[model samples]
Target: MSVELWAQPAMMSDPAPEQMMEHILKRVGDIPPLPVVATKILSMVNDPDLEVDDLVSVIQKDQGLTAKILRVSNSAFFGLCRTITTVKEAVVTLGLNNIRNQVIALCARSMLETRAEGYALEAGGLWEHSLGTAFCAERLSSTLGLKGTADQVFVGGLLHDIGKSILSYYVATRFQPILRLVDGEGLTFVEAETQELGFDHAEIGARVALRWNLPEALVDMIAHHHGPSRESKNRTQVCIVHVADAIASMLGLGLGVGGLENRIDDEAIAHLGVDDQVVQDVMVHMSSIGDLRAHIGIN
Candidate 1:
């Protein structure tokens, strides 16, 4: 968790998986806090009786956030008939759910929009990948008649790989061996990580979400996004994000060092009642969305 752990070569010198996981959990304390506004917005969104006025009051506290909301609301992308001049107006025009997605996106941008050398991601690469997955999950939810949970799924997609950020530091130190395993052994990045470091990013990410006190569903999505975890009860949401992550990778939105070394869970697809036709339709829809970065306000 601290630099001291990494200071002693003996500590990492062929440690077992349990030791590696212990180290990861200790480091969770060092993971940065979610932006205050993001935390507030997430709490509001989780509340069943949330009101636009409540969200407006929370957003109003941050002038910069309020401005961003207004700007996006008035942007041509939204195609609003009239200009939005106030937080309340923006909320009304964009709807509380849409605003919630934007808030999560904006808040996550700072943390996710950076290069992760271990993953061979350039600056902003992970952010693009996360955003693409988020959009894909949202679209998939809508297409499958699970619209009620679309927003939650979007957040899950955005955060599915969050553990990668934390693992990057350790990965940087072991990058060469991990890459060797991935390239020469034909192992996926997560597999390489598990082989070389004892734990994978998914497990680390789930712990990070738990440490941040995020929702249980989001935690499951992050933890089991590569596949379904044994403890996952929200199978629909998990499968949605799992398929979404695969779709994003297929699109080459943010491939990182892992490239396309991933598999789409056919069972996950079937679980969501998505057939090949639906997959093709989703691909077409994603292709037509043109400039996903702009649509999601990633720039």
Candidate 2:
């Protein structure tokens, strides 16, 4: 449970990577904490007796967050016929959980909006890819009948690659060594990152999820979206994100330097009790990724 304890050891010949690992772990704390309002909204939604007015009161304290939520609520993203002018109206129209997704989505954007140029993602590329994965994961959970709030998988999918945002600087500085492991030794980008940097983005992402005090399932999803561990308790959620990430990459949402390098694991496919046809259907439905920027309100 110790976030700072990494499994990957630095190369024996190189003391530098150990230093880098220390530096990387220290940097994880520098990333800001999850917004208090967003966390409060998450807590309030879990209360069965929670009322619309209660949720509205918590959100209204932050004028900017409330305004953006209302904007997205009124957009074609929801396909509502009536306009939503107030936070209460948005809660009623979109439902409490949907409104919760908007808050987390925008908060996630603060971290994800950066260029993961280290991963060959520039400007808004990381955000686009993360949003697509979140939507895909949400639909996959529904199609598979996984029991959880819509907010959980959506948040999971959205933040899966968040480590890339934080690790970009290390990746940029150590690009040559990481690349050599991948191209010369045939290591996957993640493996190379772990070997060279002493941790990969997924591990860093797990730390972020833990630091934010996000749900355990979300921590697992972000930690293992690339390849779910066999021992993970939240296997369904973790695998959904793994498959969703692959589907997002396949749809060409945000290939970055990791483009097509990542593949859908057959075990994850089987674990979800789905065949290729279901995968194909999900892919087709997810093609609505075309209007993603509008859905997320990111220009």
- Per-model CA lDDT versus the true structure: 0.81, 0.78
Q: Considering every candidate listed, which one attains the maximal lDDT? A: 1
Compared with the true structure, what per-residue lDDT tens digits does model 2 show for residues 82-178?
8889999988877777677778788778777777767989777888889989888877877777746445677888989988887787677679998
Error of 2 at 129 (Å): 0.9
Task: Report the lDDT tens digits of candidate 1 across residue range 155-184.
Answer: 999999887777777787889998899889
Return the TM-score for candidate 2, rounded to 2 decimals: 0.87
**Which candidate number would show the highest TM-score if scored against the true structure?**
1
Evaluate residue 42 in candidate 2 and report its C-alpha lDDT on the 0 to 100 scale: 54
Which run of 10 residues does model 2 get worst, by summed lDDT? Answer: 1-10
Q: What's the TM-score of every candidate structure?
A: 0.88, 0.87
Model 1, global lDDT: 0.81
Cα deviation in Å at residue 16, candidate 2? 5.1
